[model samples]
Target: MTGTPEQVDYQQLAAEIMERCEVLGRISADPDHLVRVHLTAEHKIAANQVEEWMKRAGLQTWTDAAGNVCGRNEFGRGSAPALLLGSHIDTVPDAGKYDGPLGVLLAIAVAELINNSGSGLDVPLELVAFSDEEGTRFGNGLSGSYALAGAFEPAWWDYTDADGITFRQAAIDYGLDPDKVNEAARRADELVGYLEAHIEQGPLLEDADLALGVVSSIATGTRHTVTITGQAGHAGGTPYDRRHDALVGASELVVGIEQICSTGGTIGTVGRLQVYPGGVNVIPGRVEFSLDLRAETSPQREAALAEIEAAAAEIAGHRGLGWEIEQFYTSHETACAPWLQGAIAAGIRATGQSEAPMIWSRAGHDGMAIDKITDIAMLFIRCAGGISHAPQESVTVEDVALALEAYEEAVRRSAAAAVAR
Candidate 1:
């Protein structure tokens, strides 16, 4: 963490990235502006935006078949593995300020410093901007990072977005050839390590008044689609005892998930629901819903999911109803490399913060996806009031500056390690 401290005017670079994000015009669920619906034009806008930023930094574009943007700087290439810094550019519907943009910008900032370094350190660095981590278009997150880690399976080409656009079609529309997606992926051996900087998305550091957190593990998630069916009858019904109501049963399922997660760190949600053939007078013959569960470990996550599923089945059996279930996805727990964690802590010490370097991630990230294939690490900046995913989402500019400093140090250490090989 020493060595004359590679320096740059971080404040200027951060302001530039923030301003670029600020000018993107309310990038919500617009087809033309790439709202929830992927109009294809959206990728162009984002790519061009990212391109403009890197170009301003005097770096050239290095795009791939998956639409991932790579910017590279060669310092007379020595025998060093490339240091990789990555984060996605896609956002949830009507996303807020710093969720993904900060990571992309910070990576660019790191590159800018390396580009200007007169010392010509032993390593070469690459700044990567991943596309479609939000899953707003395809309902599956981390597409670009998946490809970069060689984790994107070919079957995903058939995935369809909300508008009936398949992932293959969307890739074609985005100026990438579906036939060449396999070529888009990186060699697993070529990457040395990866790092991402993201807003904490929780209130931990905010409440504790800490400047930054070096993430120790990225939390895992389990998702399920559940359906319940029962007899349809008049709202008044033939008789209370004789009537079977799916709506009423669904209500119970919702509460059951809540009850399972009341223990604190465990989390569950029945976020989406639909009742068939809608009418107030109807008894609701069918109901479909979703289940979301999260935990620090697989056992805890599996237990929570199993409990919820069991409760649904029991309620159905007691009410003379039928149910069906389909699992959507599950993420395995991703742990940070301890060596990388220590280097980040050293970065924190450089910034003069003394609190035990906090480390935890409940939100899913591109880092988690990459962890499935390579060594990965992350840093979390506190979000205000423990709130995120809304326009009101915020982080202190001062804290952001500290993160820029810390991540730069992290990038340097990672590069230094890679160059040692």
Candidate 2:
């Protein structure tokens, strides 16, 4: 693999990525499942393994204060801001092998090519294997990126995991000084821009029969925990007209959410629902459910959410039930920089994908966090069946090959864009 754009060994790169993914896949907390949570021993081992690989690729590597595995190809350019490239290294419980780790491994592969090819880009490249993007351990995603962006909230130190361990304690256990975690923050002026290569985690590219695509924007999402309360009664004694069934009201709201989101690109999901007492012979006294709403843009998502909320109110009122909705998570839509978009498109073209389609990511990514500090862009490679976060998630070697070539080209283009700026 030479440094020249045309000399990349796509097949070899693809094979290496797959091999590395398998190796990391084995370092899970559960022997029966893949669950690498934030700041866990399993996560530490995975991060350290990647750090060694980064060093092997001829870069200065270190585990950041936030537990992120960071590597930099400085090219001896003192104080010149570097182009940031990477993706999360953490995974959701029982997650697929490629979702987060693939991006990091691919980045390292590209760095290896650049260093071994005897040619380097004008601007320096920094690779980051973010420690905690899934938020599986602490329920707060982007922990690593947030630290890097200098936006980490001190209040999160009190955040606890399922095992009753505080985030600060976990950090300390992971060999990171929680008090000095801010040291992980990178100044805005020190980064030219950010780019990430990831699995599309959707079927669009596979549907379009394309190997690669550039992201246009990331979808905005709103999540709510809803509770419908009503009087409880014996299932047999309560008359239909007299009954104020919370479950019924919740069911109506669920139907309303589905009907409202069916017409547009907006999506709604009721992922969790719980009935009070879970009794088979009692009318439900209360019902708690979760609603996840997303759209290509924030306004659209907000509009749909408003409609859903109104429908919920109407259903609760008609059913003689009291309702409460609390929004717990919200993320704004993030658009890729125009220049980086063009650069990614150029990379796609260089990989023989002349008519590269621009797709919007419905799933959240580290780019959503990094966007706060600098311009961000994403390259999505096709995955099989659009399945992710599961054991069945997969990508073809052919697609991986194309992604590698396009990714390498994109780095060169990103470096050039930084120089131009």
Question: Which candidate number has the best lDDT?
Answer: 2
Q: How far off is model 2, as Cα RMSD?
A: 1.3
Q: After superposition, how far is residue 179 of candidate 1 from its true place, in Å?
A: 0.8
lDDT (10s digit) by residue, model 1, range 1-421 = 0112444555655666567666553454463432423336765677677777776555667788788878766577754466678777776665676788778887776666656655544566677878878777777788788877778878888888767889898788777887887776767566677888888898888778897888889888888888999988888746879877888888888888798887646788788999986788888889999887788888888888777779989999998888887888988888898877776777777777786465668888988877766688888887888676776777766777788788877877776766564
TM-score of every prediction relative to native: 0.92, 0.98
In model 1, which runs have C-alpha deviations exceeding 4 angstroms?
1-9, 25-39
lDDT of 2: 0.90
Using TM-score as the measure, the top candidate is 2
| TM-score: model 1 vs. ground truth | 0.92
lDDT of 1 at 200: 87
Count of clashing residue pairs in every prediction: 4, 1
